[model samples]
Target: MMLFQHHNTGIHLDSGSTFHLRTNEDDFKEGSLQGIHGGFHYASNVKGRELYQEGIDKVFDSVCKLDTRASDNVNSLSNMVQDGFDVFMDTNRENSFFVTRNGTTWRFGHHCRVPQKAED
Candidate 1:
């Protein structure tokens, strides 16, 4: 499994198969998953169709749960930034950042700076 972002949207790809999840709803509306059945058609032939469906279902469930947690983390970070926290990107690690809030520090990866709170 690999997680990455494109055009400011998160994507989770299963390396074993062509199955993937997109964070943006628009990606689905735009038919990003249109040809997915065709890609996995052979899997049903090799494995029973029921087994293939079950495996895909499991992967889909896991991906959905992961995406939910990621979204929650992002929201929490955004709130912190709004409440005067500062996030500095970590140069040593890709997609990592140092988040400081009221002198308490935490590190998180797969996210960078959150938008600053608007002035009154």
Candidate 2:
């Protein structure tokens, strides 16, 4: 959501224009884990559910304010937040979401976390 706020038009970082750097899945998931790891809520708890809904609402409201014309579709900021949250909660380390100057493009990708073993 913050990325869209800064780069609503989605320009490439190397285009000589300033834009937020993309976050890989590993880093993003790790950060999110660190943020909520101390919490005592699991998926079945009322507090966990409340916190989840609160986060969704906050993201929705923020996106609405930042991108006035966006909607709950793939091309909209709100949906991006929704999907990102889902992926994060699922601990999906293989998928990453990013935007490009070309437009809002959500692509599935993988981040290599281990070095390849060469055959002897």
lDDT for predicted candidate 1 compared with the true structure: 0.32
- In order, the Cα lDDT scores of the candidates are 0.32, 0.24
**Model 2 regions lying over 4 Å from their true place:** 1-33, 37-40, 44-102, 107-120
What's the distance in Å from true for residue 57, model 1? 32
Q: Which pairs, if any, clash in model 1?
A: none
lDDT of 2: 0.24
Tens-place lDDT per residue, model 2, 1-120, is 221132232312122212112222222222232222333222221222211111111111212111112221112433444434221212353343443322333332234222111111
- Model 1, position 33: C-alpha lDDT score: 28
Top lDDT prediction, candidate number? 1
lDDT by residue for model 1 (2-120), tens: 33321333332222333233333333332222223333332322352211111111211222111211231122334335547586775665455555655544444443332221211
Q: Lowest summed-lDDT stretch of 10 residues in model 1?
A: 51-60
Q: Return the lDDT, model 1, position 102.
A: 52
